[model samples]
Target chain A: MVLALSGAAQTLDSTGRATTLGLLGRIDPRARLIATLLFACVVVASHWIPTLLIALAASCTAMVFAQLPIASTLKRMAAMDSFIIFILILLPFTMPGEAMFTVFGFPASWEGLWRAVEIGLKANAVVLMLMALVGTMEAVTLGHALHHLKVPERLVHLLLFTVRYIEVLYEEHVRLKQAMKARGFKARNSLHTYRSYGYLLGMMLVRAMERSERILDAMKCRGFTGRIPLLGRYEYTKRDTVFAALMGALLMILIGTEIYHAV
Target chain B: MHIVDGALSNPVVVTGAVLAVGGVAYGLKKLPMEKIPAAGVLSAAFFVASLIHVPIGPSSVHLIMNGLAGLILGWAAFPALFVGLLLQAAFFGFGGVTVLGINTVNIALPAVLAYLVCIKGVRSSNLTTATVWGGVCGALSIALTTLFVAISLAMTGEEFIPAAKFVFFAHIPVLVIEGLLSAVAVYFLRLVKPEVLGAFEEVKR
Candidate 1:
């Protein structure tokens, strides 16, 4: 939620960051879904290195087809999601396995470390697939899909409002935080902070509730009756089906290969 | 956190998907049409709450008030959380479809714990009790949730975080952050809009 919004307003203002993350937060909706599905296949096939590499290769090829900017994509992929990236980097230190090459007095087990890398890459692969795919598409599209998928009316309506207002709340959070800071309010690391946070949250909740009604009123006046309009219909052509099938078959092959190698 | 595609066992993931669907259905069955406005507002509140990242470690983690959810929504927290998790999965992909149940259980643990705190443990005389205990509940909630998830992943024979499930031991500071956040949220709810607390208490009732 933060990524998409900041990417749009702040990052997009800077050509450098925009070009880098553009592949992720700027893909076509249809392509995004396909890529997301393909990555999921890789998740199931993770046991095999050959399969994992093959999936990665396939993702790369798709990235090429998607016209993702190579330099910017790689750079942004690393820079933007640094926390998960850090967690990935930390896995080798924690995992237990046989000896690999030691660096700076750290006994890095190749097995444990490589496994960490695999997990990390798998995590990245999912992100890339989404970035390369739907990271850029409007979330409302997914909400609409949720509606068509027969998600509960209450749930879908809640979801639609949540996503829409998340941005609003983010902005509110920033303005409020700024105000707090400007007023010399500092959040200490202790139990006492709860009162302020609770009170602030309550206020935010009230404001958010009022906004929801206003937004609903505006939307209802404009003919939104708690339902997202089905914007465009997606068709499964034989070729698309064939492609999907081939992808599935390939995933199965990878799984089989991984099991064979593991055994 | 939304678990991504194929992140955990298909059975675990599918089970969560199934239960998440059930949670919403269950909530819907019980939802009074009159509270639709509050429900919508809470949903939006939840989205924004998560957007505001609370500092943890050298980095930050978003606030997910499963405790507050429990305190206010009681069983209804199930549906709210399910929707939030679903969005996180679809949008940011923090947690996955497979780990949904596990995540839900993890988050819901604190929420229900908070419910227990408000009902069985804490005194309603002081809003501070709700705030303080709610914070504790929040901290313990995610801590347990994370512990359960790490253990579950290990049990699944998946190598995601093969280390001891005691990452929550490392997450004490983070959980404290959650406790503080939840307490504040609950405190404010009681102070100005005591009605919200009334509604919340009624849920526990």
Candidate 2:
């Protein structure tokens, strides 16, 4: 389990690789982001199978285009789906409608089951769409894209810095935990355990703040103001335009079908 | 409790996003220029806080630490928690992107509330009072977050009502753990760096 977690951490730390297996990976990050958001909004707006399936297909296509490692991404999706498992178990029993069958004298509703599946599908689709669009880009590049898209400067900087330092803090946490374990700190339902964890967190915070202060001083020494100069200007290419057109067409079909069904 | 995407109905998600935007705006307005680095570091702290799984009952639960965040960051908790949630969703897929707004509101709103409820007490001269109040507010924030998450889920569909209630009850153990964690954290911070208790005040000024 520890090895698996460390491997996951490595993937997170190395999210900036420029290599990709699909054309989507090569598009302007801003455009890819816009398309992803648009697709997600549409996905949320409908519960129709065809529309949801199309959205899923589009997301999968994008992922394939980006040449994302399917197995790892799917593992992540499965992890997120853990909650839906509960929803699936409970929804059938609680939903009031035509009973599918009786379970322990309580009737399971078909409507409830369908709704759960729809939600599950929507969840999976949105996660995949995000993986395809935002997940493929470097964190810094995404921050830059958001900045260029006129997101708040403070928010952009906050995101950039948090991403930059999270791994560092995680390492600090690991070291602290190891030290506690080395000293025979076995976790149990006791005040001693909680307090030990608390001190660990408190110490991490203190260390992080001191580190940030040093970083701030360094930035100031280098003539750093609050605003980080935006990096990596992106120009829309022919491929980007073609991708946008394809996305627009797909969105229209999905929306048109949704409206048609509503009528 | 992070509300994943597609779990909530459209109206709830939209309302959550709108409210979160308001909270973030207010947080930004209160954020001092010099405090930017502190905010970032704390945001990272809150994010990493989730990785430490404390043994609770048959399983362990991670600390959300929104209460400690609230006590230290005040209104700045809004943007601080939002950034953490965003990165978690993007990098780890802990939560979905579309539901970011509601998830932000669910988690950070309670942090803001915890700030209001315990900030004065945490700054008290009496160490015992500060620690007790820190624990109270820490647990209260988790309770509030659970409530918010429950409401968000229940609003999506009636079937979720039982699940919603279960969520709250399920977190009762977490509340106790969080309270203890916050109390000790407060004690430590008071001894080592009392100024952190006043960091938000400096930012507001």
Q: What DockQ do you compute for every candidate structure?
A: 0.39, 0.65
Question: In order of the candidates, what TM-score does chain B achieve?
Answer: 0.79, 0.96
Of the true interface contacts, each candidate retains a share of 0.32, 0.68
Interface RMSD of each: 4.0, 2.2
Candidate 1 matches the true fold with a TM-score of: 0.75
Clashing pairs in 2: A22-A65
lDDT of 2 by residue, B179-203 (tens): 9899999989989987786476653
Q: Model 1: per-residue lDDT, tens digit, A141-235?
A: 55565565565666666666566666777677677777778877667544444456656676777676567568667766888654555554555
Model 2, B72: alpha-carbon shift in Å? 1.2
Q: What are the TM-scores, per candidate, against the unseen true structure?
A: 0.75, 0.93
lDDT of 2 by residue, A1-263 (tens): 12121112223335554343356667888998898788888888788877788888877887677666788888988888885588668888999999999978999999888887878888788878787777777677778899989999988888888877887888888888899989999999887888898999889988888888898899989988777887668898998899889989999999998888889
Model 1 ranges off by over 4 Å: A1-35, A38-42, A63-98, A101-109, A186-195, A213-263, B1-21, B32-37, B55-61, B96-101, B116-123, B157-162, B198-205
lDDT of each: 0.59, 0.83
